[model samples]
Target: MKGLLFDLLFYAILIFACIYVLPNYVIQRTIVDGSSMADTLMDGENLYVEKLSYRFDRLDRYDIIVFYPYGRDNTEYYVKRIIGMPGETIQIIGSDIYINGEVLEEHYGKEPIADPGRAAKPITLGDDEYFVMGDNRNISKDSRDKYVGNVSRENIGGKVIFRVTPLNRFGPID
Candidate 1:
């Protein structure tokens, strides 16, 4: 009976770690809530966000990330692609995005940006700041909006690495 009891307790602990610790610190399941990343990540799709990579490496431009807008205190999380890295100046002239006065070459934007928003003028990022935007540029409220300025490294949750739901769409996300 004592041996059985010990086994039960050990299994309970293992189950707890799998259910709580892993999801919180390792990889978590997240759902895409909007069309901001359409044609890349669609709404209602389930994704696996890995929290380990950013701990060891710096976030690179074009990496899709999930973050708490403003701060972690806010419940809502925004997923966006990093456009401008730390210490870079970002500005949008017409439909082109300029990073440090050079036009950024990326084909992620579903359509030409219709509004420059705050990015109409050059915005320099701090050492820990990153400028992000949605793939659906015209409708996405991202760094261009006053509400979701530059995302701080601390507010970043993790990188979206895989798609799980809608079985046909299951694969690694670019």
Candidate 2:
């Protein structure tokens, strides 16, 4: 009878651990489904999103982040990179990103591609808004797309620190 009681207690503890502790402490698994992050993140790659770092530090340029957009429903989330920050003017001209009237030299993309002319007009981000773009400029529907404009700080979920799937392709995201 005592053995059975101990076994029940152990099972209860295990169940509690899975239900509460795991979700709070462990990484959440997600899969990249679109070509938006191409050349940097491939389609169908499994990823472990890190939720701990952003809570302690400020996000930086080139950081790959995940954010919930303003519309199109609550179930979907968008992933992109931080390009233009608050109080900066962002413009896309001839496939290059210009911040505050200066050309940004670093390129994560393999080749130069024309802007879709979707958001050809220059946009100045609000103090709490961030401008994001996909590395795969040609294929990605990102900040350049009218539908997904500057992302507000409130909608940002977290920054992605690494990729954990596809076995051989797993590593830190640039």
lDDT (tens digit, per residue) of candidate 2 on 92-143: 7887778998988777865676764555668898988888888887776777
List the candidate 1 regions with Cα displacement exceeding 4 Å: 1-6
Q: What is the C-alpha lDDT of each candidate?
A: 0.95, 0.78
Using alpha carbons, what is the TM-score of model 1? 0.95
lDDT of 1 by residue, 1-174 (tens): 999999999999999999999999999999999999898999999999999879789999999999998699887999899999999999999999999999999999999999999999999999999999999998898999999999999999999999999999999999
> How much does each candidate deviate from the true structure in C-alpha RMSD?
1.3, 3.1
Clashing pairs for model 2 are none
What value of lDDT does candidate 1 attain over all alpha carbons?
0.95
Worst 10-residue stretch by lDDT in candidate 1?
A: 69-78
Instruction: Score residue 118 of candidate 1 by CA lDDT.
Output: 97
Model 2 segments more than 4 A misplaced:
1-26, 71-73, 116-118
Question: For model 2, where is the 10-residue window of minimal lDDT?
Answer: 21-30
